[model samples]
Target: MLAESIVIIGVNHKTAPVAVREKLAFSGDCAGPLLTLMDIDGCRECCFLSTCNRVEVIFVASDPAVAAVAVRGFLFAKSGLGDAEAQQYSYLYQGKEAVAHLYNVAASLDSMVVGEPQILGQLKQAYRDAVEQKTTGVILNRLLHKSFSVAKRVRTETNIGGSAVSISYAAVQLAKKIFGSLQDKAVLLVGAGEMAELAAEHLVRQGIGRVIVANRTLERAAKLARKFNGTAVGLAELTTQLAEVDILVSSTGATDLILRKDEVKPLMRQRKNRPLFLIDIAVPRDLDPEINDLDNVYLYDIDDLKNVVDVNKAEREKEALRAEGIVAEEVVKFGLWLEGMELAPTITAIRQKANAIREVEVAKTLGIMKSLTENERRSVEMLANAIVNKLLHEPMIFLKNSTPHDNPQLKLAFIRQMFGLDKESPEQQPPRENV
Candidate 1:
C-alpha cells in the first residue's frame, strides 16, 4: 500500500512549451529543492529531477493528494502561473502509474529524442543530490535504484541506442560511411550555430584530424572553434578553407545559399578532386543541392539527414516497445514486493503472539507436574509448538494469497484486530494507510 503512495508531478516537453519549462526548471544543486520537498507535510521520501526537457518531483507521501498539490505549487513558484494554469500545463501520476512513468523516463522512452542518453545521467545526478541531502528513504531508494537497473537492461537487451537519431548525428554517420574512417579527416563547420556545433562535436569525437569553423562574424566562429581546439576563419575564407577539409557541414541563417555549386566546383579541382562530403542542415538551405552533381562531391541537405533519422527512429520505436514490456514486468515485480510489505507486519505480530502464549502455557504445565522427567517436559514443550504452528498455518495462507478478488488491507486489519495485536503494543501496530 506504500507503493500506492508514490507520486510524480511535473511538466515535460509534451505537457509544456519551452518558455514555461525554462521558467520552472531548477538549476545548480538539488539540495535546496530536495530539502523543500522533504519539508512538505506527509512527503515521506523524495527525489528531484530537472533537465532541459523535463522537471519532475518523485516522492512517496502519506497524503498523496495534498503533497501533489504542494509540489505543483512549488514547481510553478517562479513561473508566474496561477495554480489553475499550472495544473493545466503540468502532469501528475500516482501509485503504479508513477512507478511506470519513472521507469519510462529512466529508460529514455519519454525523452524528446527517445533514445537520448543524457537524461539518465541527469537523473542519476538528481538522485545523488537527494541522497546527499538525506531526502530519500526506503521506498525512494529502492525505486530509484530499480529504475537505473531497468534502464541498463533496456540498453543491453535492445538496440535502442545503436543508431543515429538526430540530424547532427545522422550527418556524422553519413560522413563516416563516405570516408570509411574519420581519423585522418578534416571537417569545416559553416555557420557556428547549434546544429553545426553539434556536428563538429560528433566529428571531433570520431577522431577527425582537424576542425575549421567559418561564420559571418569571426568572433562567434572563433568561440565555437576553440571548443574543439580547431581553427576559426571568416566567411570570406570559405573557398580557401573548402579546399582543405574533407567534410563540410553548413547550417547558417542566411537567406540565400552560402556555398553555391560554382563556388565549390573549382575547389574540387584545387584538391585534385578528393572526395568531399557536404551536409546542409540549415532551414533555407545554405549549401546548393546541385553540389551533389559534382564528381566525387557528396551533398546531403536537412531533409536527407532527416530521412536517415526517420529510418533510425523507426528502429528505436520497435526497440522501445520491447523496453516497455521490460518496464511492465519490473513494475509487477515491485508491486509484489510492496504487497509483501503490506502482509509482513501482521504476520510477524501473529507469530510473536502465538509463541508467547505457547511458552507460558508449556512452562505452567511443567511447573504443575514437578515429578515429570526432563524428557517429559521437552515432549510437552514440543506439543505446545506443534499446536501453535497448526493454529497459525491457515491465517498465514490467508495473508499470502493476495488475489485480485481479495482486499489485503481489510484482511490485515481484521487479523491484527482479531489477535489484539494493535492493543498489545503501540510499536507493533501496523502503519496506517488511507486505503
Candidate 2:
C-alpha cells in the first residue's frame, strides 16, 4: 500500500495576530476554488478551516514531504508574503503531529481563551464545506467524525467549557463595570450573529433589565430578540435606541465604522448625561474609537476585552489540562486506526491470492472427477473454501493484531511474499492516502 499522511499547515492566534489570520480567511465562495486548486496540485483529501483567530489547511497527501512544501507555497501566495515572513507566522505539523493539533483545535484547547465554544462550530462548518465540495474522502471523513466524538467527550468529561473565556464573555464583564450590576441595565446588541447573540445571552443570565437586538436584517434581529425575550430593531433604529440603552454591545460584519463620532455625539446628549458603556468586538470596530473621549461614555474594543479574558483564563488552565488528556487519548486511538487502515491493502491482496489458488485447485479436481454428480462437485468446492479459510485464519489474525509502527512496509512486503501475492497490482493496494 502506498503510504498516506496527514498534514496541517496553519496560522493561529498563537502563531500570528488576528490581522494575519483575517488576511488568510476564506469565505464560503472562495473555499471551493481554493480546495479545488489544491486538489489539482495533488492533495488527496483536504479541508480548509478558517475562523476569526485561525486559518488552517488540514489535508491527506500521497507524499507528506511534497504536500508540506506545496501547502507552504500556496499559503505564502495567499498571504502575499515572502518565504521568510510566511515561515515566521505559520506552523506546520505532519502525520501524528497533525492529528494531535487538529484534536486540540476541535477540543478548543488551542483557542485564544481555552474552552471557548465558537471554534468548534466554525470547524464543523469548514468540514461541511469540504464535504459539499466533494474534497473529503473516507479517511478524512472518519477522522473528522472521530474528532467530533473526541470534542464531545472533552466537553462532557471536563470543565473546560464551564468558564466564561471568550471575547464576548469579556464584553459582558465590561458591561458589569459600567452599571456596577447588570440586572438593572438596559442593553442594546448591535448585531444578531453568534458573537452578538452570545454577548446578549450572557447579559440575560446576569439579569439585565431589557435587551434590544439590532441588525441589517429585521428578521434576524427579531429571531435573536425572541430567543432572549428582547425587542427587535432595524439597524436604522440604532440611533434612537441609543438613548434608551445603558449598555451597547457591537459585533457587526461591516467593513467600516458603523457608529461614528458624529452620530454618537448627539445620542450622549439625548441620554441626559447618563453613562453609556459600549463594547465593540467587531474586527474593524463597529463603534468609533473617538467616541471613547466623550463624557461618561466608556468604550472597549476587541483588544480591551482580551484583558478581561486574561483574568478568567487562569481558572480554565486546570480544566484545560484534563481536556488535553482527552485529546491525547483520542490522538492515539486515531493513530491506531490509521495504522490498521494502512495495512488493509496487503490483507486484501493476501485474501484475493488465497481465494484464487483455492479456485484453481478446486477446478482441477472437478475436471478429473468427471463422473461425479453436480452435487458432489459443489461439495468439493465447499471443502476447498473451508480449507482456504482455515489455512488463512491465523495469518489474518496476526496481520490485524500486529503493531504497524516498526517498518510497516517491510512487514507488508513479507506478508505479500509469503502469500505469493507480491504481483504489481495497484488496484489490490490499499486506498491512496495522498491524492
Candidate 3:
C-alpha cells in the first residue's frame, strides 16, 4: 500500500535545457511555500527536489490521476509554460515507476553526470526539508530512508563513487593547478550559497587555512562560516581581507559583480605580490573578468572547471555501467516488494468476505438447530470457518504473488466475481447514483 501511494512529476536536464531547468528550480529556501501552492486535496505527503540538472516533486496522493494533473498544472503555471510544452518536457510516474525513479536518482544513475556524488546530498536535503515542513508522511519517510540506505550501499559496495567524478572536486583540482599547494592558504568565500558552501568544504578538506565568508547578508555569511569552523566578515570588508586571502571562490546570486577589478587592484598592491587563486563558480560570475589580467592573480571560471569535468565524465560513464547493473538488480527487488504491497489489500478483502459468508451460513443453520446445546452450535461455527479458510487458502497465496503488470485487469475482475461484489462498489460509485 505504501509503495502504490507514490507519484512523481518532473523535468530534468535530459528533458530540458539549463534555461528551462533554472526557471523550474525550487532553490530549496522557498520550496515549502511552493509545495503549499501545489498541494491538492488528496495529496497527503509531498517533497520537492530541485538541483542544477532536475526539478521533481514526489508526493503521496489518494487519487494519482487527479494529483498528477494538478502537479503538472502547477509546474506549467509556475514556469509560464503552456500545457503542450510542459507535456513535451515533463514526465509523470506513479506507483512502482515513481519509486524506481527516486531510487535511481538517489543512487546517481539519473544524474546529468553519471556517478555525481552531489545528488545524494541534495536528495537528503530535500527529504529533510519536507520532514521539517511536516509534508512527509509514513510512506515518504520509509521511501526516503530506504533511498539513503540504497545510495550508501551503492557507494560503498561498488567502484562508482571511487571513480574520477564530481564537478566540485574538479573545481578544486583546477584551483590546485594555479596554486601548487593549498596548505596554509587563506581563502575568501564570497557567497553563503550552497555551491559556495560546498566549495568551502572542499577547500577546507584540502587543508586550506583561514577561510573567510563574505556575503551581502552578514547573517548568511556567518551561518556558512559556522558550518566550516571559519570566520565570517561583511562584504564591505572584502577589500581589506582580499590582500590577506590566497584563494577567492565566489558563487552569489547578485545581479552585478560583487568584486570588480578596480576594487581588487588596490588590494593587490597591498598584498606584496602573493599569488591569489580565484575560482568563479557562479553563473553570472561574482568576480570581474578583468581580475584575471592582474599580476600574480589567477582566475578560473565554471567553463575552465567544465573541461576537467568533461574528461572525468567519460571515465565516470565506464564505472556507471557497473553501477547501472547494481541499480537494475535493486530496482527489480523494490518492484517485487511494491507488487506484493498492492496485492495485500485485495487478499485481505477476499479473506474477510469469505469469513463473513461462512459466518452467515453457519448462523442460518444454527437457527434451525435451536434445540441443540449452545456448545454444539459454537463447535459447528468454528468448523465452518475453518472449512472456508482451507478452501480459499491456496487461491489467496496465488493472488498474493500475482502482479498488476502481469495481469492488470484480471486480478480486480477475479476478486469481484469471486466475492459477488460489484465491479464498482457503491462507495466508489458516482455521486449521481448515490443521489
> TM-scores for all candidates?
0.69, 0.54, 0.51
Query: Can you tell me which runs of candidate 2 are displaced by over 4 Å?
Result: 1-4, 166-201, 204-312, 344-435
Q: Give the alpha-carbon lDDT of every model.
A: 0.88, 0.80, 0.77
Q: What CA RMSD would candidate 3 show? A: 15.4
Residue 403, model 2: Cα distance from true site in angstroms = 28
Better of 1 and 3 by TM-score: 1
Candidate 3 local lDDT, 293-352, one digit each (tens): 999888888887777677777766776777767767766766654453445656776777
Per-residue CA lDDT of model 2 for 149-258, tens digit only, reads 78888887888877566777667766665677777789999888888888878888889999999999999999889998989999999889998889888988999898
Q: Is candidate 2 or candidate 3 better by lDDT?
A: 2
> What residue pairs clash in candidate 2, if any at all?
44-435, 61-434, 62-434
Q: Higher TM-score: candidate 1 or 2?
A: 1
Best by TM-score: 1
Worst 10 residues of 1 by lDDT: 422-431
Which stretches of model 3 miss by more than 4 angstroms?
1-5, 25-27, 30-38, 165-205, 209-311, 342-435
Give a tens-digit lDDT track for model 1, residues 1-435.
677799999899999999999998588878999999999998988999998899999998889999988999999999989999999999999888998999999999999889899889999999999999988876787789889988988887899997998888888888888888899999998899988888888888888999999999999999999999999999999889889899988888999988888988888889998999998889899888898999999999888878989999999999999999999998987776555456776687788889999888988988899998889888888899999999899989988888787745557757766888645223233347542
